[model samples]
Target: MGTLRDLQFALQLKIEELRQRDTLIDELELELDTKDELIRRLQEELDRYRTTVSLPGPSVVSAAASAQIEDKQRAARQTVISEPFIPDAATLAMGSHKSCDKNQKSSRLIKAAFLKNDLLNLNEEEVRAIAACMYHTTINQGCFVLQEGSIGDRAYVLEEGRLDVTKDGQKMRSVEPGDMFGELALLYDCTQTYSVSAQTDSKLWVIDRKSYQTVLMQCGLSHQAHSVELLRGLSFLQSMPEDVIMKLSDHMKECNYTDGSYIIRQGDTGDTFYIISKGQVTVTEKKPGREESIVLSELCERQWFGEKALWGDDIRTVNVIAVGEVTCLIIDRETFKDIIDGLVSDSCEEVQKSNASKIKPDEDPFLVSSTLSDFQIIDTLEVGEFGHIDLVQLKSNIKHIFAMRVLAKKLILHNSQREHIRREGRILMEAYSPFIVRLYKVFWDVEHLYFLTEACLGGDLSDLLKDKGNLDEYCTRFYTACVVEALAFLHCRGVVYRDVKPENVILDEHGYAKLIGSRCMKKVEVGKRTWTFCGTVGYMAPEIILNKGHSISADLWSLGVFVFELLSGGLPFDDCDQMKIPTTTIHGIDRIEFPEIISKDACALIHTLCRSNPLERLGSSRNGAKDIQKHEWFEGFNWDRLCNKTIPPPVIPKVQYPLESSACALYGEGSVKQCMNWDDF
Candidate 1:
């Protein structure tokens, strides 16, 4: 019975233990369920935040905007924190350009440190403006305080520095505190002669000359000696209107002189007169002084030199070699006279009138340094032949108009037509006929030779034809007469002008014609004749195509074609296909046609000029001018007036051309011919 009872107790205990284990497992499951629910709620919150905060795709937010948003988020987060701190206005006052009012000691000290005793008189605004003008500059030891030979723009007052002054490499003196220097270049009418060097690391108050002058004027300090010095430096004395020198005369101390120094150098003339200012100075003899040595003389402070030079005599009479170092108040001539007359001189002292057009200087530093080293470039103007030509203005406004056959530099060295073009220019100059184009001068510059002459100014006949389309009877007669005169002169001179075309004929301002380029200067072999046909394609005669040498008469035939082009607006016989084909090249001079509208007399003149045989061509005689004079078409015209008349220029070039941009492209005589034709042989 005892054993059974023990077993029942054990079973009861085991069952109770199993019930406790089931309870623990139920608690564990409940905790796990609670943790899963919390995690899901947090994930939902995060997803909602991401929808508002995160950017879509690769879209970027700017840093500034992002910072602002982040600040807003931080503010929101701080509000949730429930504690915030705000600073008072007093905190903002601690950082700024303003000083504290309560700190009167510090404020007063700062004000006093900046404003000297003299500045105490100025109001706050005036003080600030004046202070703005004053700049503090630091200089290293041994560095230049002010350099000699440099334009003086600024003057300095030393605050904490020592400086040494040297004149022309000689030591003058050293200065301590409150010493001022370098008012000379600014206050005197002279180039700088002294250099100031810093003896120690220094601080200085610098003011520009203009500001300094303003300060002096405001102070009413004309009675001071520096006023005279200031007046001497100014260029436009007549503009001054007030004579400050008389008030400052007593302060103008005289300077002394010694040997071996110049009192006044010969040929170094200026307007300023000097009191002998003590000591002896030697006057230089003419011959030796000009080439070598100087002479001497003795004078006093009341005595003066170079007074005559100031009164219109520009040449210095003597070279005064000082027996010693010279010192003088040395007022400028205008300033002295203005002070004496109690009036300001109205004369500009700095710049002198330059003689650029009339003459070139023997030693022109500007030209030596300038890039235009070749043919002297003068100006471009509307001229004959080319429509626009360059006029090379020589010494004394003597002008030359040139038709540069070539402008490109490369062709000058390698092109074959250089000799012919040069010869043509020379021949034209030699002819000196009023009808022919004249050459004035020739020179090589920038790798190209320039042929300068008077510009025709009325533009070329080609331009006229292009502009007018067709010529009137009066225009036709006028142009024809001028050309015939030119051709007659060329023929008499034994010159054959081959390139006769509208472009080769230019009109003067009065509508008279002038012949331009010539192709008759080609080198002819002895008895072998140069038959390389050259002329305007439409204007060439039939004989030019037969490999026959052209004579001066060929030009007359060409002139007839030119007149035809002028009157009819187009070539009489223009078959482009025929002109291009070698077999069909024009070989008949008589093929030229006349318009139905042409007058009989004009037609007769054209026939004579355009004859198929060179012998029959007008102006073909040995006395071609006489023949042209006898033409019936020129009956009423005054031959003398027509030949000798000077037409007023069309346009006077009035421009101060900028140097670099004005240089024309130098296409030499050779380069120009490269584009022209000389293919027929």
Candidate 2:
């Protein structure tokens, strides 16, 4: 009986052990499933790259796909060049081996480089002199490390787990250990080039500029010793200064016509040069047997075409068609000329002799000219209870025309209110670009305060949004960047632009947009943490409407709504009163809804911008709207292409003077309080 019991006990122990093994397997499977889901999401973002094209020309491989192919080629080239780094066969034949202790020490060193951020504050000789600084932090799965629009200051080295880099919400790759990402932003000081999300719980080290500079000063580092390293290091050159790379990158443009597409035809005089970004295009000559199309080149990614006719004043060399989708970048002749001119001239280095003669400010050298001393009466454009704008001819033609905005006396009774108005004027002036009116002077006349700026002849963006049909992504990108840059500049100064609406955005002839004078006149309560609900109703972000503390992100939200109006030719959320009779009900409140028709990129951008949570709004996230700028929709824009230079202004067709009468109606009525402006102040 005892022997039988002992055998039974042993069987019971075996059964329990098997059960434990099964549970372990189940847990492992669950973990694998979680990891897979993270990978899939990352991959989904990568796939968003499909619609990306080289532009004008179509291609067999999408831009994202081509990038992958290039990466593989570069990787293979690296392996071949690095073969010399391996131990020699003679060493192996000698039976020499690395000790386990040595291997352990090496592993520790790698781990120290990969899993630490304490290095950020330390500028040690080793870290500082090494030309690459290592810093790391942990990231959870689904967290995006890098995003499109925000500028990048560092390049990351993946230490553990994986990451996915995406553009336009598409995943470009599953980057894993030993992979480096975000070098482009660091190299250029421009916005983040792509969005990066962790595919798993990740550990990463980022090499920042200071550390990198420190490393480059090393005496041991030389071009000959690190030729392969140099190439890898220079991968960051994709973000090189636009002037340095534009010509070479321009050479990468491929131009071709698919069967259905038109290549240039007769009598088109506009200047444009096309380079194929992808695919084969056919050229046809109409003489005899030549009538049939002949393929000049099977233009794939990186192939150059369309230069001979563009360089000189030549007409179309041959009629062309895209055999397939052709992707190409079309450089307008004017812009091309501008670039070539910049290259040939030393204008960037040569400042005018007149500029050097001016006295320099001991501090804040950016302060150019001082405010105007006096001004005579001018023709009033609009006078209201809040403020007024006047059309004024400055002292000289070189002075240009200026608009004067005066705050209403009633609104400035409170000393705090007067101070707030002054601050707001500065903020508003900074929040818009040169496309908008450029604020040149702000001061107080005897009876009136003045905010003066360059006048735009074309009128406000609100009118354009309403009158023009739906705006395309191309136009929206052009405007959004201008406004965002304006906002960024304003925010950096610690000024909050509480008011952002379509009515405030004025357009110039060159399609450049600007913030008009209305923002300067709005009433502002001093010492308040947040402004009152001041913006036009439909354009206000929910947070602002709720009187939550407004910030730079508020302007971003307004921009989203503004873009929606531009694209849809109407508002995203319509006025309830507009529909006298309601159709659908939400929480027993009847509502009307309309189908949306806009590019997916615009829609996504709007959705992000108009989020109810201010934290999630565009430019407020960890990475922000920089990612939005990098979307596939904005593929062809050379961001550096538009900075600090005068853009070809939007084409304003000849409209009879007094546009308000032609489009909707021209009428204005408002009252100013009894007290004079200076007295109220």
Candidate 3:
């Protein structure tokens, strides 16, 4: 019933949204009609002026005169596009082995030498920092820089002399000075497929995976924040999706200009965009026959120009010169073109609203209308300390199956969980979404309280993950999307879901994930906070763990942990070195090293959502879940299909029917003496 109601509500919302859009379109059309009149008058005036003044060429009027360009950049810094420490995982077969302290190398690095390694895509400052972290080492002649089939921990840059890369003792390639080798090992623990040996007494620079990824993540976070913040402030791109903005930011490069250096010169053919990030830059135009340029305007930090390059206007008409030392976030046209296709066109909710029956195929079974006596107990699904959840079948219709949560009233009273149980029951009864389990009905007797809900024969994500080890990106994405929908549904109703994890997600007959019953959710109004310090360790957000008042952002943080764990098979904050980990805060999440197995895109999403500051989390902005849904990682995802259940789930399970049994018979009305406290149910 809840699902049915929410679908109806969703339809109403979609209709309203479309109505608003239609009104906006009408208003825009009216504006265009006015603009057309102005254009006709201007054209007449232009024709008169052209005949009088003898214009340079024949007159032409283009239809594109009123169309606005997609004023955004298409370039990222070539030196550091993303996760520069590792190559594209799909391109390389990876292996890693740990090396002891004795195997670690140290040697002198030539400060004056220019490093020529394709593997390191970093600016001069990053390169220098990496160089400092790299210990100098020497390999004796004929010594293996790495042995075939041996696991390794560090990557090396050839500083002096040379080495041989061989397979089966046959030289396959030569390692020259400034070349990088064994770089993949720095990302993960894997065995070498081949061998590298010093052809001479060679000097090498070595940096481990931990050091390299840490430095890059630190720089990437700061750079990502600055670029994204700058992009977010621009007005023309304001309506662009957040994911596209993040994509542009990732591909954007930082360029520096000293006094009088030209960022973009007049009359030069250019397709690059720039955002002034530091100091000031003077925009100037060189008039015809003028020796010196006239200053048009000055742009400072957070200001941008040159977006015309993203469109067809590739020629720079004016020079942008640095007033002093100026920094810019720049992107080229090709990058913009590559990422612009990801722009979200329209909401598909309207299509869903058009469906005649906006309800799941499995509508409410007769059990919701029937009394308790019409259902017979099948078997106990889970035996908890409070009571047990049992599978049940409708006596009148054996085909209908459901799960009954039978909690002992006495136990709930003793545990002081009556209010929590009441809240959960109320939420489950009121909430509705395809991503959330539908609670059919609530009942109470002298001994136990019962919560009848939809039975998910496919089991839960926790069990599925246990059986499959860990999910691939495809499965992880699907599950994360489902969870996000569930959380969004709950959060929109002013509910703060503090418990968000795989164990709470169950897959239904169609294998689509749904958030089941939750006890930790609270009805927090807008801008309100809850002080309850409850959540699973490692999965809880920093605010919850610190007893800091929290809102829905905590759920988003846990969603980050859910995504990270599903992809990498472990919690981000969890590690063997417990002492080294801080207890008060998770502010050092930037320092956590993600396995190379997780894609850079996935890591980027996780980082944004898992920020220490709740307000800074990706979805915590005013746009909420739309920020996360439009993340670049979820590009091309069909949210409408997910809502409509038209998309097949990542996993499907064989359905199992529980046979009728008497296990729940012992927990009937006469079983307990203390049931007076649960009268509300």
Give the number of the best model, judged by TM-score: 3
What overall lDDT goes with each candidate model? 0.50, 0.49, 0.69
Candidate 2 lowest-lDDT run of ten: 77-86
Query: Which regions of candidate 3 fall more than 4 Å away from where they truly are?
Result: 1-365, 575-585, 658-681
lDDT at 19 for candidate 1?
Answer: 67
Predictions ranked by lDDT, top down?
3, 1, 2
Looking at candidate 1, the ten consecutive residues that score lowest on lDDT are 77-86
Error of 2 at 422 (Å): 2.2
- Candidate 1 lDDT, 164-235, residue by residue in tens: 889788988986655555533222222345788889867666655444333322322222334454444545
The TM-scores, one per candidate, come to: 0.38, 0.38, 0.47
Summed over model 1, clashes come to 34
Per-residue lDDT of candidate 3, residues 447-516 (tens digit): 6788788888788887777678789999999999999998877776668877787878898888999988
Q: Count the backbone clashes (under 3 Å) in each candidate.
A: 34, 40, 18
Identify the superior model by lDDT, candidate 2 or candidate 3: 3
